[model samples]
Target: MRSIWNGAISFGLVSIPVKLINATESHSVSFRQIHTEDGGRIRYRKVCELEDREVGQDEIGKAYEDADGSMIPITDEDLARLPVPTARTIEIVAFVPEERVDPLQMGSAYYLAASGAPAAKPYTLLREALGRSNRVAIAKFALRGRERLGMLRVVGDAIAMHGLLWPDEVRAPEVVAPDAGVTVRDQELDLADALMATLGEIDLDDLHDEYREALEEVVAAKAAGETPPQAPEAAPPGKVLDLMAALENSVRVARESRGGETSGPAEEAEVRTLPRRGASSRWTPKETGGKKSTSTTAKKTTAKKTTAKKTAAKEADGRKATEKKPVAKKPTAKKRAAKSAQPAERSAARSTAEKATGAGKSTGERSTGAGKSTARKTASRKRSA
Candidate 1:
């Protein structure tokens, strides 16, 4: 890309020549009005309001408006004739820590690149000096006949120039009335800190311009001979009461929803901790019904399985009922054979339970010798029987 302006950086007598400024950070969509029937371009022309006559490019002049609404016209030739204000120099006025600058003063940012006949030593010196000092150099220069202000700082091992607005250009902060009724408790502050801690590191690239993407989509729809969809209506704000409580509840809901998205199946499967005894009252009618319905299906499932496996006729009947949505129910033949095998199964199950009990025991003596011997004797007798 071509450089927007030809310029040089100046600190004292040294000039590390560079060219580049006036780059736009954003792009605006432009539409051309056209004739509905003929599809001919509908062009606009400049017309003098007082004379009611068309004005050509030669007649146009830049005008500056005064505080009292008076206009002073300045011609292009006059603007060009004005003496260049340090055209080849970026005269530093002061050096200030970057954080001292208010965010409101920030405008556009541009990369500072060395032009032809690169002054490598001077550029390196400036970059190194700024980094060592931990300060940005504020400077004034002129471009396109308008006096411009800028800040030069070391950004990630490279020099970046950021344009800034004048203090007068920025609107003054308005006074806000204090909410005397509002007071925060230590517990609330602690919770707030915890919530903030959960919000981890900052990643600038993580953000995207959703509005611009939506607008582009709308434009594409129009181009495809479809009407653009209406924008979503804004949601009304909820009533304010117990502001901290509302905020805390909202945060919890958001965390739960987002947690469900990021959590693994194992993490989500964890059982919820129950309330302490006497901490909560018995459920009301509505709550009782809601809780009961959720448990009813689980109880029915268990009952159906028990009734099916325990009896031959019931097992057959249950299999027919479950034909629509199948479940693996134990077979009657397996159950009968399991009865003869029951003693063996019970012995195996007992041995398994004994081993499990031994493994889980805190007392080493009972678990080590006696438990194993007793378990082995019982298992052998059952097997022989």
Candidate 2:
């Protein structure tokens, strides 16, 4: 945090020595010029116009113009020699009611704190005195080598100093003169006050720099490669609104809505979770609700389903592994050799058995042929006799 002006609060003869001021305040907004293509920062150089050349900061000097347009150069020595009397002190010229000072006269506001090691007693004394009086101290102080008239006011427990423009420095309002034909009725004023009353509290937190926030939201959306959601359109005011009637109707509707505990999405969600329900599937809060919390609930459900699907897949794989797995045939030399020899031994035994059976069948066939030949010969001899 930078100090706006480090000057001691001096009352009577007692003086507290401190530094003068800070040039920048946190409330002041700053922007940097950037190259659109590469996002490179843009910088500026000090150039002497007459010489048509860039100049170093050390070569620069302050100057004032004379009546004849001749420049009277002021050196560092001249600036040091000038009577900057109010640099080290807040010389309270007078204490005046804060409301008497127009807000237009007030320009820059800065938080005031004691600088270069705090002097507690003097600071407390000044704060207490200002608070009790309900008045701000109007004073003159040197800042940026120029004398400025300012007001030092107490805000809450702390002091804030504000720079003020002179009376002639303020510009007049440009509003045109009112017409003599026009007049406001008392009824209209009363109705307007009624409408204002309906506006509830003036909480600054409720209202904000909406345009800036919206612009920033757009920028962020674009940066993330997304199209921003469109802002809701504002409703236009009714042409002829009955102020009291509207307020009464609003109050009535609010009361009616709050009275009956409707079957909301929350209740629906609770019902779905009950054990007696036939369906095993989990129900979302939005499903039974007339209003849609569906968008939020759907996202949550989808995430949960995705997680469940992954878990199910893992469980299935585990079950498959636990079930009987097919045994693989061995490709080792010992197993291969044993299999080969077993096949060969079975082939040799079958070959030997076939040879013995073939020999017995051949002998039976020879005997049968001989018996048939003898029977034929005997029958031929009998026929001849």
CA lDDT, candidate 1, residue 60? 85
Clashes of each: 0, 2
Cα lDDT computed for each candidate against the true fold: 0.67, 0.62
* For model 1, the run of ten residues with the poorest summed lDDT: 263-272
Report the C-alpha lDDT of model 2 over 261-287, residue by residue, as the tens digit: 322111111111223457555553334
- In model 2, the runs with Cα more than 4 Å from the true position are 18-43, 66-69, 116-118, 172-181, 228-385
lDDT of 2: 0.62
**Residue 91 CA displacement from its true place in model 1, Å:** 1.2
RMSD per prediction, one decimal?
A: 20.5, 29.1
Per-residue alpha-carbon lDDT of candidate 1 for residues 1-385, written as tens digits (9 for 90 to 100): 5678776888888887887744455655667899999999998989998899999988887898999988988876776566765654667788999998888988788777777656777888899999999999998876666777889998776688888888889887655666568878875575565445444355898887887888888999999999997888999986555545554554455457556333211222222233456764455333442366767779999999888777977777677567723212222222333345457675664564456444542654445454445445554665786
After TM-score superposition, the amount by which residue 211's alpha carbon in candidate 2 deviates from its true location, in angstroms, is: 2.0
